[model samples]
Each structure stands twice: as structure tokens, then as C-alpha cells.
Target: MKLTIVSRNPKSTKFPVTLELAGTASTIKTSDVNKALAAKFPKYYPDRQRLTTEDKKVLDLDKTLEEQGINEQSSIYFKDLGAQIGWRTVFMIEYAGPILIHPIFYYLSKFIYGSSFTHSPMQTVTYYMVMAHFFKRELETVFVHRFSHGTMPFRNVFKNSAHYWLLSGANLAFWVYGPWFAQGRAAAVRNDVWIYGSVAVWAWAELSNLITHITLRNLRPPGTRVRAIPYGYGFDLVSCPNYFFEFLAWTVVCFLTTSWSAFLFNIVATGQMYVWAVKKHKNYKKEFKDYPRNRTSMFPFIA
Candidate 1:
């Protein structure tokens, strides 16, 4: 096969270089081809390369050349995907923002909500919940979750961090503990009942979310890019049990706090999670013939 590598910088190489394969096209995996290219070029590592056809159809690294309809005479274009960041690092950065930002807003409430505003007991409870939620996420990022894709584009760290930092941290904390919300806490008896009841539900959601993450981590062993149908525990209820529980937790927060910011964040997160769940559910059906027929995405039968 003659492979062509398109440089991001025009001055880098002498244009696309032709490579001759040493083995039968049917036997060579797309990943093996990237290894050979990396060997000759030393710059385009397999993980950093985004291979595509002449017509711009992206190639799957997991499949063989024969499966992709490529032969000895076919030409493929290699695009260099800039700097990469570890998935763990991206997750850590994203979760860390919420942990720090939530506390900052809580402590600086006098400045943000003015000197007249008095802190409510519910505010203290909310502060603790926000801290615990992000801290647990940080712990999971470090030890529990196992990612199939080791790295992603480095630029994605900013985007991912912004979501957690802006919505879950700043928006959630600012409104829930603000003076406007303190006025609503006037119904102290009713508020206490809702807050305490929701705390129990939130605790259950958080624990279930952790369990689903562990189940997913076990599905793919370390150092392998294998995928399997997830079963048992929360998986029996929804395709993305983690998402369902996460949504449940946030929904509980929104109801307990009665804050528009919390409700907005929950809505945005649910929309994003539903999109991801739908994609994952579709992929499971496509990849595994034995995938559960009755399994929906994040929701039960309604989705």
C-alpha cells in the first residue's frame, strides 16, 4: 500500500511520502500500518494520527485493511492531530474546578450576596454536598474509572472544565446560596423537610452512580481496547446508569434548593447525557449481537 501523510505544517516534510507494505494487505491491521508509518516518520504516532481515505472517510484503527476495502494499491491520507492530553488528566481538571469554585463562592458569599445577607443552614448543607460530589468525582477519576481512549485533544480540557466550573460550580453555588434564595428559605419548616428528604435520595443516587462506574470499569480490562455488553446492578435499568443517577442527583438538588440555576444546569446536563446515551445505545446494538433488546438509553421506556 502507498500511504500519504498530510502535514499540518507545509514546511515540515517533503510532502506525502510513499510507503510500501511488507505483508499481505488482508493480514495488516490499520493500527499496524500506523506503527509502520510512525517507524519511518517518527513524528506521526498511532495515537496522534487520524487516518482517512482520499475522499475524507476516517479510518478505524481497530479493523484490518481488508475489512476497510483497502488494498496494496490504495492510498490513504494521514492527518496529524496536534498535542494530546491524558483522559485522566482531563477528568481531574474538570472535576477539580467544581471542588475549588464551589468553596470560593460559599466563603465569599458576603461579597457576592452583600453584607446584609445571612447564611442559612441550607446553604451550609448545599456547600457540603457540592464539595462532596466533586471530591468523589475526583477520586473516581484517579482510581475507579478506566477509559478506553487513553488521550484526547489537549484543547478539550478547557471545554470540559468550563462545563463543570461554570454550571456545577459557579452557577449552582451562586444562586443556591444567594440573598434571593435566602428569602425563599422563609418557609423554614417546609424547606427543612424537603432538604432532609432530598439528601437521602441524593445519597442513594451518588452511591448508585459509583457502582455503575465500577461496573463499567470492569467491563474493559486494563491495557485493552475491548468493549462488552454491561449487565447487572444499574445496567439492568438503563444503558447509561451513571447518567441516570447523575441526573437524579442534580434533579434532587434543583428541587431541594428551588434554584433556577440548579434547574438550568440539570436540564443542560440531561440533554447532553441523553445524546451520549443514545449514541452509546446505538453503538452497543451495532457492536454486539447479543446486546439486550429491551434496554433503552438513559431513561426507561419513555426515552
Candidate 2:
């Protein structure tokens, strides 16, 4: 349907025309538009997700009401902006959840460090909980194709029913049961070095994790049009400085956490990333004969 567009910004002009929603809208009933506006500008309006027309007529923001011959009687209002992103596009192997989640990284980091200051087991524990929670979602999203289920599972998508169940199990384990594993091992001789060191490792590692994950993995970051090619691996860097840095960061976390829980977790998790990085590096060399000869997998330069 053609949407009427207007701008709160003076530089932009209003237009009226029907623009096809291409991976841009899951469903529009005027309610979705209001929800979009509210999410992006919560300060201006309340109950963002609940905004809709009384009679249920959807309004198009891409065109002006005049262009569409919109009558005042029409229930929907044409706002200055459309959804910065559509919910449909968010679910399409890209970034519906990340965009929503990115805003809280600072707070997460703060919480971790703040708890680390007190050396409180409770606060530090909560910090790692969020990481595994987010990481778990990323894992599920990355492997979503393996799963054949959605909110409503279609028969046509049943090919990966097994993968679906497996993903569901992972989701439960990581998000729900992930914390039980984050706790580090107990030691009879607890040194201040180990305690603070683990806290430092977890704090920085997660911070770096946020950065690399966002930069390398974020699909629809702001205005960028290019997708990540798993570049660190394709460069023939076997250790993948990214994964290495992550390990370095987490090693410290293990010290502070002082539990077999974290040790076992990193052993499995980082080990998988390491193996994948090596294979990816090798694949890069095989695929491109001219792969960089000087680069090592995890370490930089010095051949």
C-alpha cells in the first residue's frame, strides 16, 4: 500500500505514494507503525507497542496524507519517520534483536565492574548471566536455519525438525541453565591475584566480546550494507586474534571466579571457536592461493 510521508525535519519534504513493503513489514495494521514510532522515540509517546487506530486502518508514513487523499476521518497518523527498521527484516538473519540489545552494553559492563569493585559474588554472577544470555540468543539465531520451528511452525519448514529441537535445547541450557556453569572452581588457597585477575579477565573479555561481536557480526549496523565474511578467519590467521583476545579476557575471569564452572565452560566454548578459526583459516588459504603468508591465526606479525 502507498504510504503518505512527512518530515519533522525541515530538510526533507513530504510525498505520497504506495511503496511496497519488502522484508520491511511483517504485518501492518496501523498498530505496528505506532509501535515502531514508540520504540524509537519513547520519550515522545507512551505505550509504543500498543498504539493503533480505533477503526484499525493502517497509515503509511512514506507518503503525505494529502497525496493519499487521507481524510481526517482516517484513524492513523502519519509520523515523521517509519520504523528505522522493520520487525520482518529484524528476524531475517540480520538484526532485530541486536538493535534492541546494543543499548545496554555499557550498563552491563558497568554492572560487572561495579560488582567487581565490591568483590561481591552476587553482582559478578549477574553480570556473566547477561553475557551467556545474549550469546545464547546469537547462537540460536545463527543456527536458526537448522530449526524448523517458529511461533507457528509451517509444515513446509519441517525439514530441520531435529535441528529445531537441538536449538531449543541449547536455548534452554544457555539462557536458563547457563549460570550454573559460569561459577568458577573453588580453591583452598585463594590468592588476591586470582580473585581480582578473574574479575579483570571477565570484565575486559566481555567488553571486547561486545565490540568484536558487534563490529564483526552485526549484520545491519546503522547504515552499513556489507555483511561480515568471517574476515578474521579468511585472512589465514588461525588463532583469530579475535578469539584469542576473548580467551585472554576470559582467563582472567576464571581467576576471579575461582570455579570449575567457568573453566569447563571456557574449555568447551573457546575450544570450539579456536577449532573453527583454524579451519576457517585453512579454508581461506585453500580458497585463495594468494592468502597472506605473514599472518598467524591468533598472534600478529613476527611470522
Candidate 3:
């Protein structure tokens, strides 16, 4: 059987190949065709896993060519999956998850649970702070951050959405909002010093995080993947100042709300950020000879 392999790019040349179908009853799989394409055009399809498409729609790579209704003389186009969902889409979805999810639970506590503003003003402040943090993240995703790759796996969007949305709902609803309603205005306002101090810290951390992100974004030109040793701001003290500031922001929220849910969320989030920062710091040291040796992974003087 003869099949035509087409490149998605119109300028690129196409080729025809013959497959032997006389031997057995088994159908020819996409993997078999991919191997044949690699052998014939090694430069074109260096990674055969990326060689797939349905000109009319999307092709399932797991299916046999015959099972997919692909017959002799059928043209299967080659496409790169990375082009489907770009980096902007990934960041937008990730940042939007928390922004959308947090507000729903926050408002629901007020309207559905009858936790009005007079009951606790501190709850209002906490609600606004959470919204502000996620809103800033969404703005940063659009304007401040520079992504190295054009796209990520499509499934990652769902995974990331679930992580942020579920966590935000649990943290904000139970700890930040629900407790204030249950305890009333007196209990909420009892910790005047702690509440005010945490709010101040949260504000400072949020500002510092934004500055660090902007500094990092300005380091490289648009569409370029150049990585430079970050300096100034909090970078002089820590390799991942952004992560450190983020940890501080959440820690302050935990203190202000006095919620175990908030505390546990902070612990888990900070641990993950620390691990990522450590790996990134090692990569920076390995990649750049002049990368600072004094800077810790996330903290100023400690890991």
C-alpha cells in the first residue's frame, strides 16, 4: 500500500512511501508508519512522536492507520503539538484559576452564609488581600513574565487549574471567611496588633514580588531565551526572591487569619517553591560561571 506523508508547512516537500500489507492479518499502527518516516526522513521527523495530524481535524496517534480510515494514497500531515496551546494560554489559565475560584467562595460566605460586612471587617480585608494577590498574578502573567517555551502539554492546564482552584477554595472559605462569621466581630478584632502587622507584611511582600518579576522579565528581549544572573532587588540575597516573597505573603495571611487551613496551605506551598528554587539555583550555577555563590535557594541565609 502506498501512502503520502505531508508536511503542515506548505513550502515543505511531501513524500510517498510503500508499505507491505501482504504478510499478516495485523493492521499497521501509527508507530510503524512513524518508524518508516524516521528512517526515510530522519531530519524532518527526528522525534516520530510529533509526526501526526488529521488535515480535516485531529488524528489519534494510538489508532492504526487503517482504523483511522487512512488508506492507500491518503495524506497524513505532520504537525508539532507545541504550536497548539501557547505559553500565554498556559499562564492565563493558571493565574485565572485562583482569581475566579477565590472570589466565588468569598462572596458565597457573605451572601449564602449570611456573613455580612458588619459581622467582621477583618474578613473583608482578608478577602480583598487574597483577590489582590491573584489579580496581581494574572497581570504579571500577561505583562511581566517571559516564557521560554511557546507551549506546554494541554493536560497541564487542567492539572494546574485543579491545584489552584481547589486549594484557594479550601483556604479562603474555611480559614479566612468562615471563621470570621462563626466567631463574630469581637473575636475577629481581638488580635489588633497581629492583624495590622501581617497586613503590612503582606503588602510589602506583594510589592517586592512584583518588582522581582519585572526585573527578571526585563533581563531578556521578546522571543529570546537568554538567561542572565539576576541582580538587585531581593536577588542579591536569594536566588529565587520571587518565591521567597510569595512564601512571606502567604505566611502573613496565615498569621492574620489565624487559620490552620491557611497555615497548612502555606507549608505545602512554601515547601514546593523551596524545592523548585533549589533546583533552579543549581541550574543557574551550572549554566553561568559568574552566578553568585552566596545566594541561597529561596531564603536570605537559610534554605
191-226, model 1: which lDDT tens digit per residue?
567778888999999999999999998988897788
lDDT of 3 by residue, 183-260 (tens): 555557646777677789999999999999999999989977787988999999999999999999988888777777
Clash pairs, model 3 backbone: none
List candidate 3 segments past 4 Å from native.
1-84, 110-119, 179-187
Global CA lDDT of candidate 2, please? 0.42
Q: Write the per-residue lDDT of candidate 2 for residues 1-303, one digit (tens) a residue.
A: 333333333554432222332122333434334444445456424222222233435444333444444433333433332223322223332322332332343234334333321223532443464445456445544542222111222232233332222232223222322333223523223455655555666666556555455445444444333333444432344336667666666555444444454455557657676777778667656766766666665545522
> Which candidate achieves the best TM-score against the true structure?
1
Report the C-alpha displacement of residue 96, candidate 1, in angstroms: 1.2
CA lDDT for candidate 1 = 0.82
User: Considering summed lDDT, which 10 consecutive residues are worst modelled in model 3?
Assistant: 16-25
In candidate 2, position 119 carries an lDDT of 22
Judge candidate 1 at residue 196 and give its lDDT. 86
**TM-score order of candidates, top first:** 1, 3, 2
lDDT of 2 at 105: 33
Provide the lDDT at 129 for model 3: 87
Over 4 Å off, model 1:
1-14, 20-22, 183-191
| Candidate 2 similarity to native, TM-score | 0.36
